[model samples]
Target chain A: MGFDWAVIHDNLPFLMRGLWNSVQLAAITVVLSFPLGCIVALGRISRRRWLRYPATMLVHALRSNPLILIVFWFFFLVPILTGRPVGDFASVLAAFVVFFSAYFAEIVRSGIQSVRRGQLEAALSTGLTYAQAMRFIVLPQALRSMTPSLATECVIVFQGTTIAYVVGMREFLHTTFLVTERTMRPVELYLFAALVYFVVCLAGSIFARRLEGKAGIPR
Target chain B: MSDPLVSIRNLGLRYGTFRALEDVSADFSRGTCIVICGPSGSGKSSLLRCINRLEEFQDGDVVFDGASLRACRDLPRLRSEIGMVFQHFELYPHLSVLDNVTLAPRIAKGKPRQEAEETARRLLDRVGIGDQAGKFPGELSGGQQQRAAIARALALEPKLMLFDEPTSALDPEMIAEVLRVMRDLARNGMTMLVVTHEMAFAREVADEIVFMDKGRIVERAETARFFSAPTAPRAREFLDRILHRL
Candidate 1:
């Protein structure tokens, strides 16, 4: 019935905690998954069937299944199997890690493959081993070419963290849901949450644009 | 007088079901410049790539110096001894000219950074692109990039150098600069196998001319005799077709 400034003032600390958890989850997921994504990318492109098959299967399976199911599986099944208590945040994080890593692996795989065959041949003929060539020559050039796409993927991934709410992680959306249910102000609280998400995504987009500009990647 | 620096016996290569090279045999002495001229898809590039095992072969073997490449367990070790320059230059786009030349030396040979830098600088200077060592490949002109690529190959101090149409991708005006570098390399007694279309450079710089067609050596002889009085009718015809353009 009314825009309640009082409720907004009252729930500031709770919302801030939720926001911090969201940020922490995103930060940890990105740091852990980026290197893992590169390894998955390499494994997907590996010449050996032993390495490529399982990597490809993992990516495909994760991509096709629902992210919510992944969260449920990690939260409900992981503890039963490991017989150790998994933290709530860790469960949500594991799910996000699996989902985003598959996406990033595709990005890196396509990026690495976009480098021409002649480039590898030239480097090999110049006496560099495959590892040396990939490290210094191929990946650097490929990562350059893939910058714009990679930036866009990063933004998508940052926003995708909203799915962490399904696993009972108190992210931005979950905080909004909790505040609305508690105070009976669904419309106002949800609007504020949407605004927060928009602000984050916008800031991330701006930062990515700056990175592309500095890296000299044309839009 | 001594054993061939690069020797191939009955070399055959197949891609899937298609045969790219068949029963091609040759021996290249050290410090000699050999030109391989052929029509498109006649195995000119394949032949050069085979030397460094860039393109794997199906039959027979490639012997580099005294070692059999086919039998050797480590291909990277053998490749280090054979330097190759490509038609497209294929310089790494993200690296400066200096880094492009020094990467293999530092990584593959485990050379110290100072030594690698020194060797890279000397090679850059030798190839006439010392001033552009800090420039990325996309920032340089086509001719300058190709020269940098050559310097990259030379930084390894290879026993043999291979050129696959080094000048073919350059602009007409730029071709002479790359050819000049090639001629200089030949004059320095760096054993080379060049697959090129520039007949003038071939006639002037090549110690021997090898004419290939249908995946086999049609004819090979001293540059003068091959260009002036060819042995095979195919060589004469190929020469007649390209030479009259000048």
Candidate 2:
């Protein structure tokens, strides 16, 4: 009851396409969410209650809910709100960005706070406005310190992409599941999918750990 | 003859019901150096921070260079004329010494990079770390880093300078190097407020010495008089303990 190499062999191109879609989703999510996360982080760390409270609430709300609920929330809500049918991939991408940003905001806030308080004092005393100091002195330091953590978070987002398969978005895992349906080789297909995820995440974590050392920031 | 450069009046501050500073007041004149020295947890550093608006005081106000600091709408503009050097040498570790010095002037004042870099090099040279300008703060020794910090502050061409325990975080051997730069600044007529334990440097460089205890100025006198004969018993005890430890 073992082998069906032929099913995978025949579907390699299709599977690779799915893998590319997964990567593309992850990449676009990272690029969009990181900067959005930074803005939300600033609000989270802000002195103004107007900014802090809403940002805090958003972070808590998004983080507390499971990603699947978030996926469904946008998947259904977006089309109704826009008065049209938004596709699954776009809907999932929206959910992914929203979900990942909350985590990234936390990372950014921690990174900004990790900078010695005296550094900001020095910048302020130099007559730099808070915005300018944040732009030049504080952020450069914070970005350097938070690089490893940001990379690690991106890996999680990549792994989290598999959940999109539930919505039938045809990502790597979804594509593998399709092949399994055609071949009646559930064990082989699922095992191959797990191996692929393990390999990608393993490489990503290794890269992150090396970055933590080079960044000289003790985790 | 003219008004004092900085006049801090009835300044009061608290930290959640604890009185950190109570009705503290002082006047710093132009072209003079005042060294504030006291025991740890005393109000020396807090008072310095208040002048630059780093710490918000609960009561009273500071008139800096003829304007009331509390009412000053453009704080960045007000701050630009005041320089601060921290004990830890907060030289912006990610930036080179030259970039650290040039950053504020270029960004805040709209000074061109060429102009800012020129001023930075000259100040760094004056601080005696000119050759080390290309290195990051992490790459510099404590002495070199402190000097670079001084250069960074000086680049603003501030009307007043604040040094909060400038040598307190340095190694014993590194202390003299930073103190020497401070000495040079004082002699060259940079209006400064320095909080330090180095009584000898204070004696030589400070026009006046302000001794604080438990958030109040216990005594303010000519540097020579303060060291030889302090009016306040608390100040006398502090000087005795500090000088003996040194």
Candidate 3:
């Protein structure tokens, strides 16, 4: 009959492990997806139909659907392609990678477009090949301008990691669910999970805003 | 004018229904400074862009050095041999001025970093921005940025250079410094095709003045002769209007 905070105290270590898993998942996704997204951005902006069409379709498709649907789609899709029942973690990760890359691709493509056309013209007239010019000149300016957007995407990625819990991936929110079932104190555990998510995401949002302020200065 | 560097043979271009260049032809000779000047929509810039193949034509070709631009397979090589400076500086803002100049040589020509830096410094000094090499382009003034842009094009060690209204974007005070660098380049026998409104520079340095109007060459003559007695009424009226302001 008494409201007890003891369940959260007793399960701190287990909950921390869950948080650690979330951190690892977000970190891996950020690392894998940003670079992949840059390629997709280039492909989306490319003049060639072969590269542009698929890249544009993927970005639009992933952007329209909810994260959970993507998780389920890949959940079923990965097994069919791999010809084996891959782990739930793998499916969740594939979902996150595919989903977040579309967001990042949009960010990077805008950054690329923001650079003036004359910059590309100057680079081309120098006889540097198109790829070389993008690598040496355009990307350096674009990626710098993209820093704030990239940071915000990263924060979203961290928040979105909670979706992995739907697949029974045992991430932070799922660990709270596990503790509530055992202790029969769902109210305390759910509130604790919410507080944790809010605190962490707020800090990330603050950092991204600071980057945006500084990015305004032409560097 | 006997030895030609770029020969435009019946070059024609159109944008939708509007013809940008109509059977435009000119032979730019080696070691000579040719100034192409006309009003805002005379296809002067289009003719310049065609030589570098930046603007492709539906009919005819640009023959640079010896090869025809339309038939050439190695575009990068051809472009490298011919340098172009835009109206805006278009310097790589992220790179230091030194790096901006050295980039083409180091990456495109495979020059060693040390060798490229040396040449970059020499050219930067020639353009009077020797001490500004370590600075980013955003840190420099408009005149300094344009000079750096000129040096960047020169770093390719190109046989021919194209100036597409290089000083048009500069403040009036800054124009003279850029024109000075260009004059120095001309004096050093760097064959250049200049598109500018600077009649003083044209009179002082141009071997010949090419006047275009409505996508056709209306008049072509020696700079002194063009200035004194332009045969075309359009060319005469253009000179009168532009010179009246000065």
**Which candidate ranks first by DockQ, i.e. highest?**
2
User: lDDT per residue, candidate 1, B63-170, as tens digits?
Assistant: 889998888888888898888888899988777889889988888889999999999998899889899999889888899989999999988889999999998888
Spell out the clash pairs found in candidate 3: none
What DockQ does predicted model 1 obtain?
0.55
lDDT of 2 by residue, B95-167 (tens): 8889999999999999999999999999989989889989878888999999999888899999999999999
Question: How does residue A80 of candidate 3 score in lDDT?
Answer: 98
Q: What residue runs in model 2 are displaced by over 4 Å at the alpha carbon? A: A217-219
Q: What TM-score would you give candidate 2 relative to the actual structure?
A: 0.97
Cα error of candidate 2 at position A150, Å: 1.2
Q: Which stretches of candidate 3 lie over 4 Å from their true place?
A: A1-3, A216-219
Name the lDDT of candidate 3: 0.92
Candidate ranking (lDDT, best to worst): 3, 2, 1
Poorest lDDT segment (10 consecutive residues) of candidate 2 chain A? A210-219
Q: Score the docking of each candidate (DockQ).
A: 0.55, 0.62, 0.59
The residue-by-residue lDDT of candidate 2 on A1-219, one tens digit each, is 658767777888999999999999999999999999999999999999999999999999999999989998998899998899989989999999999999999999999999989889999999999999899989988999999999899899999999898899989999998888887888877887788899999999999999998985321
Better of 2 and 3 by TM-score: 2
Model 3: how far is A26 from its true place, Å?
1.3
Tens-place lDDT digits, model 3, residues A1-219: 678898899999999999999999999999999989999999999999999999999999999999999999999899999999999888899899989999999999999998999899899899988898899989888888889889889889999999999889989999999998889999889999999999998899899999888774233
State each model's CA lDDT, in order. Answer: 0.86, 0.91, 0.92
Clashing pairs in 1: none
Per residue, candidate 3 scores C-alpha lDDT tens digits across B1-246 of 576899998989999999999998889888899999999999999998888888879998888888989998877888899899999889998899999999999999999999999999999999999999999998999999999999999999999999999999999999999999999999999999999999999999999999999999999999899999999999999999999999
